[model samples]
Target: MIGRLNHVAIAVPDLDAACAQYRGALGAVVGAPQDEPDHGVTVVFVELPNTKIEFLYPLGDNSPITGFLEKNPAGGIHHICYEVDDIMAARDRLQAEGARVLGSGEPKIGAHGKLVLFLHPKDFNGCLIELEEA
Candidate 1:
Protein backbone atom coordinates (compact mmCIF):
# COMPACT_ATOMS: atom_id res chain seq x y z
CA MET A 1 0.00 0.00 0.00
CA ILE A 2 1.03 3.63 -0.38
CA GLY A 3 2.68 5.55 2.44
CA ARG A 4 3.50 9.20 2.80
CA LEU A 5 3.43 11.55 -0.15
CA ASN A 6 6.93 11.42 -1.58
CA HIS A 7 6.92 14.30 -4.03
CA VAL A 8 4.93 15.99 -6.72
CA ALA A 9 6.54 16.09 -10.15
CA ILE A 10 5.98 18.96 -12.54
CA ALA A 11 7.00 18.90 -16.18
CA VAL A 12 8.79 22.04 -17.27
CA PRO A 13 9.84 23.20 -20.70
CA ASP A 14 12.59 25.33 -19.22
CA LEU A 15 14.37 23.89 -16.22
CA ASP A 16 16.34 27.05 -15.47
CA ALA A 17 13.30 29.28 -15.40
CA ALA A 18 11.35 26.82 -13.27
CA CYS A 19 14.24 26.55 -10.86
CA ALA A 20 14.46 30.33 -10.70
CA GLN A 21 10.77 30.61 -9.93
CA TYR A 22 10.98 28.15 -7.10
CA ARG A 23 14.31 29.34 -5.79
CA GLY A 24 14.12 33.09 -6.28
CA ALA A 25 10.43 33.91 -6.26
CA LEU A 26 9.14 31.22 -3.92
CA GLY A 27 12.29 31.35 -1.79
CA ALA A 28 12.59 27.59 -1.69
CA VAL A 29 15.72 25.56 -1.08
CA VAL A 30 16.35 24.15 -4.52
CA GLY A 31 18.63 21.21 -4.91
CA ALA A 32 21.11 20.67 -7.73
CA PRO A 33 19.86 19.43 -11.06
CA GLN A 34 20.34 15.72 -11.69
CA ASP A 35 20.08 13.92 -15.00
CA GLU A 36 18.18 10.63 -14.86
CA PRO A 37 18.93 8.81 -18.08
CA ASP A 38 16.62 5.92 -17.29
CA HIS A 39 13.69 8.26 -16.80
CA GLY A 40 14.94 10.53 -19.60
CA VAL A 41 14.64 13.61 -17.46
CA THR A 42 16.82 16.25 -15.84
CA VAL A 43 15.39 17.02 -12.41
CA VAL A 44 15.77 19.56 -9.64
CA PHE A 45 14.17 19.09 -6.24
CA VAL A 46 12.74 21.93 -4.20
CA GLU A 47 12.73 20.90 -0.58
CA LEU A 48 10.01 22.02 1.76
CA PRO A 49 8.99 21.55 5.37
CA ASN A 50 6.65 18.64 4.68
CA THR A 51 7.31 17.36 1.17
CA LYS A 52 9.35 18.10 -1.96
CA ILE A 53 8.58 19.41 -5.42
CA GLU A 54 10.35 17.93 -8.43
CA PHE A 55 10.93 19.91 -11.60
CA LEU A 56 11.26 17.65 -14.64
CA TYR A 57 12.74 18.64 -17.97
CA PRO A 58 13.35 16.56 -21.04
CA LEU A 59 16.82 15.10 -21.30
CA GLY A 60 16.59 13.90 -24.91
CA ASP A 61 14.38 14.15 -27.96
CA ASN A 62 12.82 10.84 -27.01
CA SER A 63 12.30 11.94 -23.45
CA PRO A 64 8.82 11.29 -22.05
CA ILE A 65 8.66 14.85 -20.82
CA THR A 66 9.04 15.97 -24.44
CA GLY A 67 5.84 14.17 -25.33
CA PHE A 68 4.11 15.59 -22.27
CA LEU A 69 5.27 19.08 -23.25
CA GLU A 70 3.96 18.52 -26.76
CA LYS A 71 0.54 17.88 -25.31
CA ASN A 72 0.89 20.76 -22.84
CA PRO A 73 3.20 23.44 -24.15
CA ALA A 74 3.16 25.29 -20.85
CA GLY A 75 3.99 22.13 -18.94
CA GLY A 76 2.07 20.94 -15.89
CA ILE A 77 1.92 18.45 -13.06
CA HIS A 78 3.34 15.22 -14.45
CA HIS A 79 2.90 12.86 -11.54
CA ILE A 80 2.54 12.36 -7.81
CA CYS A 81 4.78 9.97 -5.94
CA TYR A 82 3.91 8.02 -2.84
CA GLU A 83 6.22 5.96 -0.68
CA VAL A 84 5.62 2.25 -0.14
CA ASP A 85 7.05 -0.12 2.38
CA ASP A 86 7.28 -2.98 -0.09
CA ILE A 87 7.20 -2.06 -3.75
CA MET A 88 6.84 -5.60 -5.12
CA ALA A 89 3.98 -6.43 -2.78
CA ALA A 90 2.33 -3.15 -3.63
CA ARG A 91 2.69 -3.90 -7.31
CA ASP A 92 1.15 -7.32 -6.97
CA ARG A 93 -1.77 -6.09 -4.94
CA LEU A 94 -2.44 -3.28 -7.34
CA GLN A 95 -2.20 -5.67 -10.27
CA ALA A 96 -4.67 -8.06 -8.66
CA GLU A 97 -6.95 -5.10 -8.15
CA GLY A 98 -6.84 -4.47 -11.92
CA ALA A 99 -4.60 -1.46 -11.82
CA ARG A 100 -2.16 -1.26 -14.72
CA VAL A 101 1.47 -0.53 -14.08
CA LEU A 102 3.48 1.35 -16.64
CA GLY A 103 6.66 0.24 -18.44
CA SER A 104 7.98 -3.21 -17.60
CA GLY A 105 6.00 -3.31 -14.37
CA GLU A 106 9.25 -3.40 -12.47
CA PRO A 107 10.81 -0.97 -10.09
CA LYS A 108 13.53 1.39 -11.33
CA ILE A 109 15.94 3.62 -9.46
CA GLY A 110 14.36 7.00 -8.89
CA ALA A 111 15.83 10.44 -8.25
CA HIS A 112 16.21 9.65 -4.57
CA GLY A 113 18.09 6.46 -5.54
CA LYS A 114 15.11 4.45 -4.34
CA LEU A 115 13.16 1.82 -6.24
CA VAL A 116 10.23 3.35 -8.07
CA LEU A 117 7.39 2.33 -10.37
CA PHE A 118 4.87 4.36 -12.35
CA LEU A 119 1.23 3.43 -12.69
CA HIS A 120 -0.74 4.20 -15.81
CA PRO A 121 -2.49 7.54 -15.71
CA LYS A 122 -5.72 6.06 -16.98
CA ASP A 123 -5.84 3.77 -13.99
CA PHE A 124 -5.43 6.65 -11.58
CA ASN A 125 -8.05 9.15 -12.73
CA GLY A 126 -5.86 10.75 -15.43
CA CYS A 127 -3.03 11.49 -13.04
CA LEU A 128 0.20 9.54 -13.27
CA ILE A 129 1.12 7.93 -9.99
CA GLU A 130 4.60 6.90 -8.90
CA LEU A 131 5.25 4.47 -6.08
CA GLU A 132 8.68 4.72 -4.47
CA GLU A 133 10.13 2.33 -1.94
CA ALA A 134 10.33 3.80 1.50
Candidate 2:
Protein backbone atom coordinates (compact mmCIF):
# COMPACT_ATOMS: atom_id res chain seq x y z
CA MET A 1 0.00 0.00 0.00
CA ILE A 2 0.93 3.67 0.05
CA GLY A 3 3.47 5.00 2.47
CA ARG A 4 4.72 8.55 2.97
CA LEU A 5 4.14 11.31 0.46
CA ASN A 6 7.29 11.22 -1.64
CA HIS A 7 6.98 14.44 -3.59
CA VAL A 8 4.62 16.68 -5.49
CA ALA A 9 5.60 17.23 -9.12
CA ILE A 10 4.87 20.44 -10.95
CA ALA A 11 5.13 20.90 -14.69
CA VAL A 12 7.03 24.07 -15.54
CA PRO A 13 7.44 26.03 -18.75
CA ASP A 14 10.82 27.19 -17.52
CA LEU A 15 12.74 24.86 -15.21
CA ASP A 16 15.47 27.40 -14.51
CA ALA A 17 12.98 30.09 -13.54
CA ALA A 18 11.12 27.67 -11.31
CA CYS A 19 14.33 26.58 -9.58
CA ALA A 20 15.38 30.21 -9.16
CA GLN A 21 12.03 31.09 -7.65
CA TYR A 22 12.46 28.40 -5.06
CA ARG A 23 16.16 29.01 -4.50
CA GLY A 24 16.31 32.83 -4.63
CA ALA A 25 12.82 33.97 -3.77
CA LEU A 26 11.77 31.33 -1.27
CA GLY A 27 15.25 30.47 -0.07
CA ALA A 28 14.36 26.80 -0.34
CA VAL A 29 17.06 24.18 -0.76
CA VAL A 30 16.99 23.40 -4.45
CA GLY A 31 18.76 20.40 -5.84
CA ALA A 32 20.53 20.17 -9.21
CA PRO A 33 18.50 19.59 -12.32
CA GLN A 34 18.51 15.97 -13.50
CA ASP A 35 17.37 14.71 -16.84
CA GLU A 36 15.20 11.58 -16.68
CA PRO A 37 15.22 10.34 -20.24
CA ASP A 38 12.88 7.45 -19.55
CA HIS A 39 10.33 9.85 -18.19
CA GLY A 40 11.20 12.42 -20.81
CA VAL A 41 11.63 15.19 -18.28
CA THR A 42 14.33 17.36 -16.80
CA VAL A 43 13.61 17.66 -13.10
CA VAL A 44 14.80 19.74 -10.19
CA PHE A 45 13.95 19.04 -6.59
CA VAL A 46 13.17 21.64 -3.96
CA GLU A 47 13.74 19.95 -0.66
CA LEU A 48 11.47 20.71 2.25
CA PRO A 49 11.42 19.78 5.91
CA ASN A 50 8.87 17.03 5.46
CA THR A 51 8.67 16.37 1.75
CA LYS A 52 9.95 17.61 -1.61
CA ILE A 53 8.69 19.61 -4.58
CA GLU A 54 9.67 18.46 -8.08
CA PHE A 55 9.86 20.84 -10.99
CA LEU A 56 9.51 19.11 -14.33
CA TYR A 57 10.43 20.41 -17.77
CA PRO A 58 10.13 18.79 -21.15
CA LEU A 59 13.27 16.98 -22.22
CA GLY A 60 12.35 16.97 -25.90
CA ASP A 61 9.53 17.69 -28.34
CA ASN A 62 8.26 14.17 -27.82
CA SER A 63 8.36 14.45 -24.05
CA PRO A 64 5.17 13.83 -22.19
CA ILE A 65 5.68 17.11 -20.38
CA THR A 66 5.60 18.84 -23.75
CA GLY A 67 2.02 17.69 -24.24
CA PHE A 68 1.14 18.72 -20.72
CA LEU A 69 2.65 22.18 -21.26
CA GLU A 70 0.84 22.51 -24.55
CA LYS A 71 -2.46 21.99 -22.74
CA ASN A 72 -1.39 24.16 -19.83
CA PRO A 73 1.07 26.74 -21.02
CA ALA A 74 1.55 28.19 -17.56
CA GLY A 75 2.17 24.69 -16.27
CA GLY A 76 0.63 23.20 -13.14
CA ILE A 77 0.75 20.38 -10.63
CA HIS A 78 1.85 17.42 -12.74
CA HIS A 79 1.52 14.64 -10.22
CA ILE A 80 1.64 13.54 -6.59
CA CYS A 81 4.05 10.78 -5.65
CA TYR A 82 3.52 8.31 -2.85
CA GLU A 83 5.92 5.74 -1.55
CA VAL A 84 4.86 2.13 -1.40
CA ASP A 85 6.47 -0.84 0.25
CA ASP A 86 5.86 -3.14 -2.71
CA ILE A 87 5.14 -1.56 -6.04
CA MET A 88 3.99 -4.74 -7.76
CA ALA A 89 1.55 -5.58 -5.04
CA ALA A 90 0.24 -2.03 -5.04
CA ARG A 91 -0.15 -2.09 -8.78
CA ASP A 92 -2.00 -5.35 -8.70
CA ARG A 93 -4.38 -4.16 -6.01
CA LEU A 94 -5.03 -0.94 -7.83
CA GLN A 95 -5.59 -2.84 -11.04
CA ALA A 96 -8.11 -5.10 -9.33
CA GLU A 97 -9.96 -1.96 -8.36
CA GLY A 98 -10.06 -0.98 -12.04
CA ALA A 99 -7.34 1.64 -11.79
CA ARG A 100 -5.26 2.02 -14.91
CA VAL A 101 -1.52 2.34 -14.84
CA LEU A 102 0.25 4.67 -17.26
CA GLY A 103 2.72 3.38 -19.84
CA SER A 104 3.79 -0.24 -19.76
CA GLY A 105 2.45 -0.85 -16.27
CA GLU A 106 5.93 -1.59 -15.05
CA PRO A 107 8.12 0.27 -12.62
CA LYS A 108 10.75 2.62 -14.01
CA ILE A 109 13.69 4.34 -12.36
CA GLY A 110 12.56 7.65 -10.95
CA ALA A 111 14.43 10.84 -10.11
CA HIS A 112 15.47 9.37 -6.78
CA GLY A 113 16.70 6.27 -8.61
CA LYS A 114 13.82 4.32 -7.11
CA LEU A 115 11.25 2.15 -8.80
CA VAL A 116 8.31 4.29 -9.88
CA LEU A 117 5.03 3.87 -11.68
CA PHE A 118 2.44 6.40 -12.76
CA LEU A 119 -1.27 5.80 -12.54
CA HIS A 120 -3.73 7.33 -14.94
CA PRO A 121 -4.95 10.77 -13.90
CA LYS A 122 -8.56 9.97 -14.57
CA ASP A 123 -8.32 7.05 -12.19
CA PHE A 124 -7.24 9.25 -9.34
CA ASN A 125 -9.71 12.12 -9.55
CA GLY A 126 -7.82 13.99 -12.28
CA CYS A 127 -4.58 14.06 -10.33
CA LEU A 128 -1.78 11.95 -11.74
CA ILE A 129 -0.48 9.66 -9.04
CA GLU A 130 3.04 8.23 -8.95
CA LEU A 131 3.86 5.27 -6.77
CA GLU A 132 7.51 4.89 -5.90
CA GLU A 133 8.79 1.80 -4.19
CA ALA A 134 10.08 2.68 -0.78
lDDT, candidates in the order shown: 0.92, 0.92
What local lDDT score does residue 112 receive in model 2, on the 0 to 100 scale? 82
Model 2 regions lying over 4 Å from their true place: none
List candidate 1 segments past 4 Å from native: none
Candidate 1 residue pairs in clash (backbone atoms < 3 Å): none
The best candidate in terms of TM-score: 1
List TM-scores for all candidates, in order: 0.95, 0.93
Supply every candidate's count of residue pairs whose N, Cα or C atoms clash at under 3 angstroms. 0, 0
Question: What is the per-residue lDDT of model 2 for residues 45-131, given as tens digits with 9 covering 90 to 100?
Answer: 899999999999989667988888999999999899999999999999999999999999989888788999999988889998999
The residue-by-residue lDDT of candidate 1 on 2-58, one tens digit each, is 789999999998999999898999999999999988778999999999999999999
The residue-level lDDT of candidate 2 at 92 comes to: 97
